[model samples]
Target: MTVKDIATLLDAKIICCEDSLGRELHAACGADMMSDVLAFVKDQSVLLTGLCNPQVIRTAEMMDMVCIVFVRGKLPDENMIELAIERNIPLLSTKHRMFTACGLLYSNGLHGGATN
Candidate 1:
């Protein structure tokens, strides 16, 4: 599915980089810890997290992720949004918790790719 489809599936609000909504994403992973994200995530284009910080954007950028979804209604500050915008990573916020959000995307055909 595409970033736009993930946003719709999670009923998320696009916080930045709306133009990237059309970007296609094959996999997703939800995590609050950046360490786990760095260590275990692989080939994932979308990240769903409850952590609202600039590091989220940085991690997404480093991982070459196409989109980041803030779950549990958590919203990023302007600084984080700016970082995501600079990196051209679409940022979205949704009311669903991390698990629920992940489930929604998975149920809609977005899977978590192989990870070590």
Candidate 2:
């Protein structure tokens, strides 16, 4: 699915990188802990998380993620947004909680990435 599709499915608002909505995303993973996200996510282009911090953007950058969905209506601060913008990663905010957001994407055919 595309980033635009995800925003529509989750009822999310695009915080930045609106021009990149056409980018295709193959998988998604939701997490609050940066460590788990760093360890488990592989080839997952979309990250769904409630954690709002600069590290979240950094983690996405490290994982080569293309987009981030902030769950539970959470919003990232200016610093986080700056980093995401610098990294060219689209940021989206959703009112749905983590589980609900993940389920919405998964049920819509966006799967979790491969696991070891």
User: What's model 2's overall lDDT?
Assistant: 0.94
Across 3-59, the per-residue lDDT of candidate 2 in tens digits comes to: 999999999999999988999999888889999988877899999999999999999
Q: After superposition, how far is residue 66 of candidate 2 from its true place, in Å?
A: 0.9
Give residue 92's lDDT in candidate 2 (0 to 100). Answer: 99
Which residue pairs collide in model 1, if any? none
Question: Model 1 reaches what TM-score against the true structure?
Answer: 0.98
Tell me the whole-model lDDT of each prediction, alpha carbons only.
0.91, 0.94
* Lowest lDDT 10-residue stretch of candidate 1: 107-116
Model 2 lowest lDDT segment of ten: 107-116
Estimate the TM-score of every prediction.
0.98, 0.97
